[model samples]
Target: MAIWQHGGMPSSKNTQFAVAVHVLTYLAGQVERGPVSSDELSASTNVNPVHVRRVLGPLREAGLVCSRPGVHGGWELATPAEEITLARVWRLLQGADPVLGLHGPNPDCPVGRGVQRSLAAIDGAVAEAVAAELERSTVQDILAREVQGACSVPGQA
Candidate 1:
Protein backbone atom coordinates (compact mmCIF):
# COMPACT_ATOMS: atom_id res chain seq x y z
CA MET A 1 0.00 0.00 0.00
CA ALA A 2 1.11 3.59 -0.56
CA ILE A 3 2.30 5.35 2.55
CA TRP A 4 -0.24 8.13 2.21
CA GLN A 5 -2.91 5.47 1.85
CA HIS A 6 -1.89 4.31 5.31
CA GLY A 7 -2.20 7.77 6.91
CA GLY A 8 1.55 8.32 6.97
CA MET A 9 4.14 10.14 4.97
CA PRO A 10 4.56 8.54 1.57
CA SER A 11 7.57 6.42 0.94
CA SER A 12 10.00 7.40 -1.82
CA LYS A 13 8.79 7.21 -5.39
CA ASN A 14 10.65 3.95 -5.61
CA THR A 15 8.29 2.00 -7.84
CA GLN A 16 9.20 3.85 -11.00
CA PHE A 17 12.81 4.18 -9.96
CA ALA A 18 13.08 0.47 -9.26
CA VAL A 19 11.30 -0.54 -12.43
CA ALA A 20 13.37 1.84 -14.54
CA VAL A 21 16.59 0.55 -13.07
CA HIS A 22 15.51 -3.07 -13.40
CA VAL A 23 14.44 -2.62 -16.99
CA LEU A 24 17.63 -0.78 -17.90
CA THR A 25 19.86 -3.20 -16.05
CA TYR A 26 18.16 -6.10 -17.76
CA LEU A 27 18.67 -4.34 -21.07
CA ALA A 28 22.34 -3.74 -20.30
CA GLY A 29 22.82 -7.45 -19.87
CA GLN A 30 20.90 -8.30 -23.01
CA VAL A 31 22.65 -5.99 -25.47
CA GLU A 32 23.77 -8.92 -27.55
CA ARG A 33 20.14 -10.04 -27.91
CA GLY A 34 19.16 -6.88 -29.79
CA PRO A 35 16.08 -4.75 -29.09
CA VAL A 36 13.98 -6.29 -26.31
CA SER A 37 10.21 -6.29 -26.34
CA SER A 38 8.18 -4.82 -23.56
CA ASP A 39 6.99 -8.35 -22.83
CA GLU A 40 10.57 -9.48 -22.33
CA LEU A 41 11.33 -6.58 -19.96
CA SER A 42 8.01 -7.15 -18.16
CA ALA A 43 8.89 -10.77 -17.57
CA SER A 44 11.71 -9.91 -15.22
CA THR A 45 9.77 -7.06 -13.62
CA ASN A 46 6.70 -9.26 -13.04
CA VAL A 47 4.68 -6.36 -14.40
CA ASN A 48 2.40 -6.22 -17.42
CA PRO A 49 3.85 -5.31 -20.78
CA VAL A 50 1.51 -2.32 -20.85
CA HIS A 51 3.07 -0.98 -17.68
CA VAL A 52 6.53 -1.48 -19.12
CA ARG A 53 5.56 0.48 -22.21
CA ARG A 54 4.12 3.24 -20.09
CA VAL A 55 7.43 3.61 -18.29
CA LEU A 56 9.27 3.39 -21.55
CA GLY A 57 7.55 6.52 -22.86
CA PRO A 58 9.50 8.95 -20.70
CA LEU A 59 12.66 6.94 -21.00
CA ARG A 60 12.37 7.13 -24.74
CA GLU A 61 11.83 10.87 -24.60
CA ALA A 62 14.78 11.27 -22.29
CA GLY A 63 16.99 9.76 -24.97
CA LEU A 64 17.87 6.97 -22.61
CA VAL A 65 16.08 4.43 -24.73
CA CYS A 66 15.00 4.03 -28.31
CA SER A 67 12.17 1.89 -29.70
CA ARG A 68 11.62 0.28 -33.05
CA PRO A 69 8.25 -0.54 -34.55
CA GLY A 70 6.89 -3.59 -36.50
CA VAL A 71 8.07 -7.14 -36.33
CA HIS A 72 11.52 -7.75 -34.78
CA GLY A 73 11.10 -4.44 -32.97
CA GLY A 74 11.28 -3.22 -29.38
CA TRP A 75 13.37 -1.06 -27.02
CA GLU A 76 17.11 -0.64 -26.48
CA LEU A 77 19.43 1.87 -24.85
CA ALA A 78 20.37 4.93 -26.84
CA THR A 79 23.75 4.91 -25.14
CA PRO A 80 25.91 2.44 -23.30
CA ALA A 81 24.77 1.56 -19.78
CA GLU A 82 27.78 3.24 -18.23
CA GLU A 83 26.71 6.51 -19.76
CA ILE A 84 23.20 6.36 -18.27
CA THR A 85 23.15 7.84 -14.81
CA LEU A 86 20.55 6.85 -12.25
CA ALA A 87 20.22 10.49 -11.21
CA ARG A 88 19.15 11.42 -14.72
CA VAL A 89 16.66 8.57 -14.80
CA TRP A 90 15.39 9.49 -11.35
CA ARG A 91 14.72 13.07 -12.37
CA LEU A 92 12.90 11.99 -15.51
CA LEU A 93 10.70 9.51 -13.68
CA GLN A 94 9.99 11.35 -10.41
CA GLY A 95 7.62 13.94 -11.87
CA ALA A 96 5.36 15.55 -9.26
CA ASP A 97 5.47 12.86 -6.62
CA PRO A 98 6.72 14.10 -3.25
CA VAL A 99 9.44 12.52 -1.17
CA LEU A 100 7.19 13.09 1.81
CA GLY A 101 3.50 13.94 1.87
CA LEU A 102 1.88 15.99 4.58
CA HIS A 103 -1.83 15.43 4.84
CA GLY A 104 -3.45 18.78 5.37
CA PRO A 105 -4.84 18.26 8.76
CA ASN A 106 -7.54 20.62 10.09
CA PRO A 107 -6.55 24.02 8.74
CA ASP A 108 -7.37 25.71 12.03
CA CYS A 109 -5.26 23.33 14.07
CA PRO A 110 -2.01 24.93 15.21
CA VAL A 111 -0.17 21.61 15.53
CA GLY A 112 -1.16 20.56 12.04
CA ARG A 113 0.11 23.81 10.61
CA GLY A 114 3.39 23.50 12.45
CA VAL A 115 3.91 19.92 11.39
CA GLN A 116 3.20 20.76 7.79
CA ARG A 117 5.79 23.51 7.86
CA SER A 118 8.33 21.22 9.47
CA LEU A 119 7.88 18.38 7.04
CA ALA A 120 7.93 20.59 3.99
CA ALA A 121 11.35 21.91 4.86
CA ILE A 122 13.01 18.55 4.58
CA ASP A 123 11.16 17.13 1.60
CA GLY A 124 13.36 18.78 -0.98
CA ALA A 125 16.45 17.95 1.00
CA VAL A 126 15.41 14.31 1.22
CA ALA A 127 14.82 14.21 -2.49
CA GLU A 128 18.18 15.83 -3.12
CA ALA A 129 19.88 13.27 -0.93
CA VAL A 130 18.19 10.45 -2.76
CA ALA A 131 19.25 11.89 -6.09
CA ALA A 132 22.80 12.34 -4.91
CA GLU A 133 23.04 8.70 -3.96
CA LEU A 134 21.46 7.60 -7.18
CA GLU A 135 24.01 9.69 -9.08
CA ARG A 136 26.77 7.67 -7.48
CA SER A 137 25.97 4.64 -9.63
CA THR A 138 24.80 3.79 -13.11
CA VAL A 139 22.65 0.95 -14.40
CA GLN A 140 25.85 -0.78 -15.50
CA ASP A 141 27.08 -0.67 -11.92
CA ILE A 142 23.98 -2.49 -10.76
CA LEU A 143 24.26 -5.12 -13.47
CA ALA A 144 27.89 -5.78 -12.65
CA ARG A 145 27.16 -6.12 -8.96
CA GLU A 146 24.25 -8.46 -9.53
CA VAL A 147 26.21 -10.59 -11.96
CA GLN A 148 29.12 -10.84 -9.57
CA GLY A 149 26.78 -11.73 -6.73
CA ALA A 150 25.03 -14.35 -8.81
CA CYS A 151 28.32 -15.97 -9.75
CA SER A 152 29.45 -16.08 -6.12
CA VAL A 153 26.35 -17.90 -4.94
CA PRO A 154 26.88 -21.65 -5.12
CA GLY A 155 24.18 -23.91 -6.57
CA GLN A 156 22.02 -20.87 -7.14
CA ALA A 157 21.35 -21.67 -10.77
Candidate 2:
Protein backbone atom coordinates (compact mmCIF):
# COMPACT_ATOMS: atom_id res chain seq x y z
CA MET A 1 0.00 0.00 0.00
CA ALA A 2 3.03 2.25 0.11
CA ILE A 3 2.53 3.56 -3.41
CA TRP A 4 5.27 6.15 -3.41
CA GLN A 5 8.57 4.74 -4.55
CA HIS A 6 11.93 6.43 -5.19
CA GLY A 7 13.17 4.51 -8.23
CA GLY A 8 10.86 1.72 -9.32
CA MET A 9 8.00 3.97 -10.41
CA PRO A 10 8.92 5.45 -13.74
CA SER A 11 7.50 8.80 -14.75
CA SER A 12 5.36 9.15 -17.89
CA LYS A 13 7.52 9.96 -20.91
CA ASN A 14 4.98 11.20 -23.46
CA THR A 15 2.60 12.96 -21.13
CA GLN A 16 -0.16 15.12 -22.59
CA PHE A 17 1.13 18.08 -20.62
CA ALA A 18 4.48 17.91 -22.39
CA VAL A 19 2.84 17.67 -25.82
CA ALA A 20 0.47 20.52 -25.13
CA VAL A 21 3.25 22.71 -23.81
CA HIS A 22 5.37 22.01 -26.85
CA VAL A 23 2.55 22.79 -29.27
CA LEU A 24 1.60 25.97 -27.40
CA THR A 25 5.16 27.18 -27.24
CA TYR A 26 5.54 26.68 -30.97
CA LEU A 27 2.36 28.58 -31.68
CA ALA A 28 3.33 31.35 -29.32
CA GLY A 29 6.59 31.77 -31.15
CA GLN A 30 4.68 32.03 -34.42
CA VAL A 31 2.72 35.10 -33.46
CA GLU A 32 3.80 37.00 -36.58
CA ARG A 33 3.87 33.93 -38.79
CA GLY A 34 0.19 33.01 -38.70
CA PRO A 35 -1.37 29.52 -38.49
CA VAL A 36 0.87 26.46 -38.25
CA SER A 37 0.31 23.04 -39.80
CA SER A 38 0.16 19.90 -37.68
CA ASP A 39 2.97 18.43 -39.72
CA GLU A 40 5.16 21.41 -38.92
CA LEU A 41 4.28 21.29 -35.24
CA SER A 42 4.89 17.54 -35.15
CA ALA A 43 8.28 18.01 -36.78
CA SER A 44 9.26 20.49 -34.11
CA THR A 45 7.87 18.23 -31.35
CA ASN A 46 9.37 15.03 -32.78
CA VAL A 47 5.97 13.36 -32.58
CA ASN A 48 3.88 11.89 -35.37
CA PRO A 49 1.57 14.30 -37.22
CA VAL A 50 -1.45 12.06 -36.55
CA HIS A 51 -0.61 12.01 -32.87
CA VAL A 52 -0.23 15.79 -32.90
CA ARG A 53 -3.73 16.08 -34.34
CA ARG A 54 -5.05 13.84 -31.57
CA VAL A 55 -3.49 16.10 -28.95
CA LEU A 56 -4.77 19.22 -30.68
CA GLY A 57 -8.31 17.89 -30.97
CA PRO A 58 -9.16 18.53 -27.33
CA LEU A 59 -7.36 21.85 -27.37
CA ARG A 60 -9.40 22.96 -30.36
CA GLU A 61 -12.62 21.80 -28.71
CA ALA A 62 -11.65 23.60 -25.51
CA GLY A 63 -11.37 26.89 -27.42
CA LEU A 64 -7.66 27.03 -26.90
CA VAL A 65 -7.05 26.51 -30.61
CA CYS A 66 -8.84 27.15 -33.88
CA SER A 67 -8.44 25.13 -37.04
CA ARG A 68 -8.97 26.12 -40.65
CA PRO A 69 -10.02 23.70 -43.38
CA GLY A 70 -9.01 23.37 -47.08
CA VAL A 71 -5.72 24.01 -48.83
CA HIS A 72 -4.57 26.83 -46.55
CA GLY A 73 -5.72 24.95 -43.46
CA GLY A 74 -3.77 24.89 -40.21
CA TRP A 75 -4.06 25.43 -36.47
CA GLU A 76 -3.73 28.58 -34.43
CA LEU A 77 -4.53 29.74 -30.95
CA ALA A 78 -8.15 30.80 -30.63
CA THR A 79 -7.56 33.14 -27.74
CA PRO A 80 -4.48 35.17 -26.92
CA ALA A 81 -1.70 33.29 -25.17
CA GLU A 82 -1.97 35.56 -22.15
CA GLU A 83 -5.52 34.37 -21.55
CA ILE A 84 -4.67 30.68 -21.44
CA THR A 85 -3.46 29.24 -18.15
CA LEU A 86 -1.50 26.03 -17.79
CA ALA A 87 -4.14 24.82 -15.32
CA ARG A 88 -6.92 25.10 -17.88
CA VAL A 89 -5.06 23.11 -20.52
CA TRP A 90 -3.94 20.46 -18.04
CA ARG A 91 -7.44 20.02 -16.65
CA LEU A 92 -8.94 19.69 -20.15
CA LEU A 93 -6.39 17.08 -21.20
CA GLN A 94 -6.83 15.04 -18.06
CA GLY A 95 -10.58 15.24 -17.72
CA ALA A 96 -11.92 12.70 -15.21
CA ASP A 97 -8.46 11.26 -14.69
CA PRO A 98 -7.17 11.78 -11.18
CA VAL A 99 -3.91 13.68 -10.96
CA LEU A 100 -2.76 10.98 -8.61
CA GLY A 101 -3.37 7.26 -9.07
CA LEU A 102 -3.81 4.57 -6.44
CA HIS A 103 -3.55 0.84 -6.88
CA GLY A 104 -5.92 -1.69 -5.35
CA PRO A 105 -4.57 -3.36 -2.27
CA ASN A 106 -5.47 -6.60 -0.46
CA PRO A 107 -8.62 -5.92 1.56
CA ASP A 108 -7.70 -8.63 4.09
CA CYS A 109 -4.39 -6.96 4.98
CA PRO A 110 -5.01 -4.41 7.71
CA VAL A 111 -1.99 -2.24 6.85
CA GLY A 112 -2.78 -2.19 3.12
CA ARG A 113 -6.39 -1.25 3.74
CA GLY A 114 -5.44 1.48 6.16
CA VAL A 115 -2.79 3.02 3.90
CA GLN A 116 -5.10 2.98 0.88
CA ARG A 117 -7.82 4.70 2.82
CA SER A 118 -5.43 7.35 4.08
CA LEU A 119 -3.99 8.13 0.65
CA ALA A 120 -7.46 8.29 -0.91
CA ALA A 121 -8.47 10.91 1.61
CA ILE A 122 -5.35 12.98 0.94
CA ASP A 123 -5.26 12.77 -2.87
CA GLY A 124 -7.93 15.40 -3.45
CA ALA A 125 -6.13 18.01 -1.38
CA VAL A 126 -2.87 17.21 -3.15
CA ALA A 127 -4.46 17.60 -6.59
CA GLU A 128 -6.03 20.87 -5.53
CA ALA A 129 -2.69 22.24 -4.36
CA VAL A 130 -1.13 21.37 -7.72
CA ALA A 131 -3.98 23.11 -9.57
CA ALA A 132 -3.60 26.26 -7.48
CA GLU A 133 0.06 26.46 -8.42
CA LEU A 134 -0.60 25.82 -12.12
CA GLU A 135 -3.33 28.47 -12.19
CA ARG A 136 -0.87 31.18 -11.22
CA SER A 137 0.94 31.08 -14.57
CA THR A 138 -0.21 31.56 -18.15
CA VAL A 139 1.15 30.18 -21.40
CA GLN A 140 2.48 33.70 -22.06
CA ASP A 141 4.42 33.56 -18.81
CA ILE A 142 5.94 30.23 -19.82
CA LEU A 143 6.84 31.63 -23.26
CA ALA A 144 8.56 34.61 -21.67
CA ARG A 145 10.54 32.32 -19.38
CA GLU A 146 11.60 30.20 -22.34
CA VAL A 147 12.76 33.27 -24.22
CA GLN A 148 14.69 34.43 -21.16
CA GLY A 149 16.57 31.14 -21.10
CA ALA A 150 17.42 31.49 -24.78
CA CYS A 151 18.85 34.96 -24.17
CA SER A 152 20.96 33.77 -21.25
CA VAL A 153 24.49 32.48 -21.69
CA PRO A 154 26.34 30.27 -19.25
CA GLY A 155 26.10 31.91 -15.79
CA GLN A 156 23.96 34.84 -16.90
CA ALA A 157 20.18 35.19 -17.07
Candidate 3:
Protein backbone atom coordinates (compact mmCIF):
# COMPACT_ATOMS: atom_id res chain seq x y z
CA MET A 1 0.00 0.00 0.00
CA ALA A 2 1.15 3.53 -0.73
CA ILE A 3 2.17 5.41 2.38
CA TRP A 4 2.58 8.66 0.51
CA GLN A 5 1.00 9.88 -2.70
CA HIS A 6 0.71 13.09 -4.71
CA GLY A 7 3.88 12.45 -6.75
CA GLY A 8 5.75 11.08 -3.73
CA MET A 9 5.25 14.24 -1.72
CA PRO A 10 3.23 13.55 1.41
CA SER A 11 -0.29 14.90 1.11
CA SER A 12 -1.33 15.17 4.72
CA LYS A 13 -5.01 15.24 3.89
CA ASN A 14 -4.85 12.05 1.84
CA THR A 15 -2.06 9.85 3.13
CA GLN A 16 -1.79 7.39 5.97
CA PHE A 17 1.71 8.65 6.74
CA ALA A 18 0.28 12.02 7.54
CA VAL A 19 -2.38 10.53 9.78
CA ALA A 20 0.21 8.43 11.54
CA VAL A 21 2.33 11.48 12.16
CA HIS A 22 -0.66 13.41 13.39
CA VAL A 23 -1.63 10.60 15.74
CA LEU A 24 1.90 10.26 17.07
CA THR A 25 2.31 13.98 17.49
CA TYR A 26 -0.92 14.16 19.41
CA LEU A 27 0.17 11.26 21.59
CA ALA A 28 3.51 12.91 22.22
CA GLY A 29 1.80 16.09 23.31
CA GLN A 30 -0.29 14.05 25.72
CA VAL A 31 2.69 12.44 27.37
CA GLU A 32 1.59 13.53 30.80
CA ARG A 33 -1.92 12.22 30.26
CA GLY A 34 -3.34 8.72 30.20
CA PRO A 35 -3.83 6.58 27.14
CA VAL A 36 -5.86 8.24 24.40
CA SER A 37 -8.88 6.51 22.90
CA SER A 38 -9.21 5.81 19.21
CA ASP A 39 -12.35 7.95 19.19
CA GLU A 40 -10.40 10.92 20.46
CA LEU A 41 -7.61 10.31 18.00
CA SER A 42 -10.12 10.00 15.20
CA ALA A 43 -11.74 13.25 16.25
CA SER A 44 -8.38 14.98 16.29
CA THR A 45 -7.60 13.69 12.83
CA ASN A 46 -11.11 14.33 11.57
CA VAL A 47 -11.13 10.77 10.29
CA ASN A 48 -13.17 7.71 11.12
CA PRO A 49 -12.31 5.79 14.24
CA VAL A 50 -11.81 2.71 12.08
CA HIS A 51 -9.21 4.55 10.04
CA VAL A 52 -7.46 5.55 13.21
CA ARG A 53 -7.47 1.93 14.32
CA ARG A 54 -6.17 0.78 10.93
CA VAL A 55 -3.32 3.27 11.08
CA LEU A 56 -2.55 2.22 14.61
CA GLY A 57 -2.23 -1.45 13.63
CA PRO A 58 1.10 -1.07 11.88
CA LEU A 59 2.29 1.39 14.48
CA ARG A 60 1.35 -1.05 17.18
CA GLU A 61 3.13 -3.98 15.50
CA ALA A 62 6.20 -1.84 14.91
CA GLY A 63 6.25 -1.18 18.63
CA LEU A 64 5.69 2.51 18.22
CA VAL A 65 2.36 2.39 19.99
CA CYS A 66 0.51 -0.03 22.19
CA SER A 67 -3.17 -0.52 22.96
CA ARG A 68 -5.17 -1.52 25.96
CA PRO A 69 -8.61 -3.15 25.99
CA GLY A 70 -11.66 -2.27 28.14
CA VAL A 71 -13.79 0.72 29.11
CA HIS A 72 -10.83 2.87 30.11
CA GLY A 73 -8.59 1.15 27.57
CA GLY A 74 -6.91 3.14 24.89
CA TRP A 75 -3.60 3.62 23.09
CA GLU A 76 -0.26 5.17 24.04
CA LEU A 77 3.24 5.38 22.66
CA ALA A 78 5.26 2.24 23.11
CA THR A 79 8.41 4.06 22.16
CA PRO A 80 9.50 7.50 23.22
CA ALA A 81 8.48 10.29 20.88
CA GLU A 82 12.05 11.57 20.76
CA GLU A 83 13.26 8.17 19.58
CA ILE A 84 10.59 7.71 16.90
CA THR A 85 12.13 9.36 13.88
CA LEU A 86 9.87 10.28 11.01
CA ALA A 87 11.99 8.10 8.77
CA ARG A 88 11.25 5.09 10.93
CA VAL A 89 7.55 5.77 10.70
CA TRP A 90 7.88 6.25 6.94
CA ARG A 91 9.58 2.90 6.44
CA LEU A 92 7.19 1.04 8.67
CA LEU A 93 4.22 2.44 6.78
CA GLN A 94 5.89 2.47 3.39
CA GLY A 95 6.28 -1.28 3.10
CA ALA A 96 7.16 -2.43 -0.47
CA ASP A 97 5.01 0.06 -2.32
CA PRO A 98 6.51 2.35 -4.91
CA VAL A 99 7.28 5.70 -3.37
CA LEU A 100 6.51 7.60 -6.54
CA GLY A 101 3.40 5.59 -7.37
CA LEU A 102 4.97 4.17 -10.49
CA HIS A 103 2.88 2.09 -12.82
CA GLY A 104 3.62 -0.36 -15.61
CA PRO A 105 3.95 1.40 -18.92
CA ASN A 106 3.52 -0.03 -22.44
CA PRO A 107 6.33 -2.54 -22.57
CA ASP A 108 5.88 -2.85 -26.35
CA CYS A 109 7.03 0.72 -26.90
CA PRO A 110 10.74 1.50 -26.64
CA VAL A 111 10.12 4.94 -25.11
CA GLY A 112 7.76 3.51 -22.54
CA ARG A 113 10.22 0.78 -21.54
CA GLY A 114 13.03 3.29 -21.24
CA VAL A 115 10.87 5.68 -19.22
CA GLN A 116 9.94 2.94 -16.82
CA ARG A 117 13.55 2.09 -16.11
CA SER A 118 14.44 5.75 -15.69
CA LEU A 119 11.56 6.37 -13.35
CA ALA A 120 12.34 3.29 -11.30
CA ALA A 121 15.87 4.54 -10.70
CA ILE A 122 14.71 8.03 -9.85
CA ASP A 123 12.07 6.59 -7.53
CA GLY A 124 14.70 4.77 -5.50
CA ALA A 125 16.77 7.93 -5.20
CA VAL A 126 13.78 9.99 -4.19
CA ALA A 127 12.78 7.45 -1.54
CA GLU A 128 16.26 7.52 -0.07
CA ALA A 129 16.31 11.31 -0.07
CA VAL A 130 12.94 11.40 1.64
CA ALA A 131 14.06 9.00 4.34
CA ALA A 132 17.33 10.86 4.91
CA GLU A 133 15.60 14.20 5.27
CA LEU A 134 12.95 12.74 7.55
CA GLU A 135 15.69 11.20 9.67
CA ARG A 136 16.61 14.71 10.78
CA SER A 137 13.33 15.10 12.62
CA THR A 138 11.30 13.14 15.16
CA VAL A 139 7.74 13.26 16.47
CA GLN A 140 9.01 15.33 19.37
CA ASP A 141 10.45 17.86 16.93
CA ILE A 142 7.03 18.30 15.34
CA LEU A 143 5.34 18.47 18.74
CA ALA A 144 7.80 21.07 20.00
CA ARG A 145 7.35 23.15 16.89
CA GLU A 146 3.61 23.03 17.26
CA VAL A 147 3.08 23.40 20.99
CA GLN A 148 6.10 25.46 21.97
CA GLY A 149 5.79 28.03 19.19
CA ALA A 150 9.10 27.00 17.66
CA CYS A 151 8.02 28.34 14.34
CA SER A 152 10.49 27.79 11.55
CA VAL A 153 8.39 29.61 9.01
CA PRO A 154 9.78 32.96 7.98
CA GLY A 155 7.82 35.99 9.24
CA GLN A 156 5.14 33.70 10.68
CA ALA A 157 5.57 34.69 14.37
Flag regions of model 3 displaced more than 4 Å.
1-14, 148-157
Superposing every Cα of model 2 onto the true structure, what RMSD results?
6.9
Model 3 residue 93 lDDT score? 84
lDDT of 3 at 14: 42
Error of 3 at 85 (Å): 0.9
Task: Give all candidate RMSDs, comma-separated.
Answer: 5.8, 6.9, 8.2
Alpha-carbon deviation at 71 in model 1, angstroms: 0.6
> lDDT per residue, candidate 1, 15-125, as tens digits?
777899999998887787788888778777878889999988999998899999889899998889998889989889886467767665656679978887877778778
Error of 2 at 8 (Å): 17
- Quote model 3's TM-score: 0.79
Candidate 2 stretches greater than 4 Å from native = 1-14, 109-114, 148-157
Q: Estimate each model's TM-score.
A: 0.78, 0.77, 0.79
Candidate 3: residue pairs that collide: none
Return the number of clashes found in candidate 2: 0
What are the lDDT scores of the predictions, listed in order? 0.80, 0.77, 0.82
Give the per-residue lDDT digits (tens) of candidate 2, residues 76-147.
888899999888887777665545667666666899889978887787777778788889988888888774
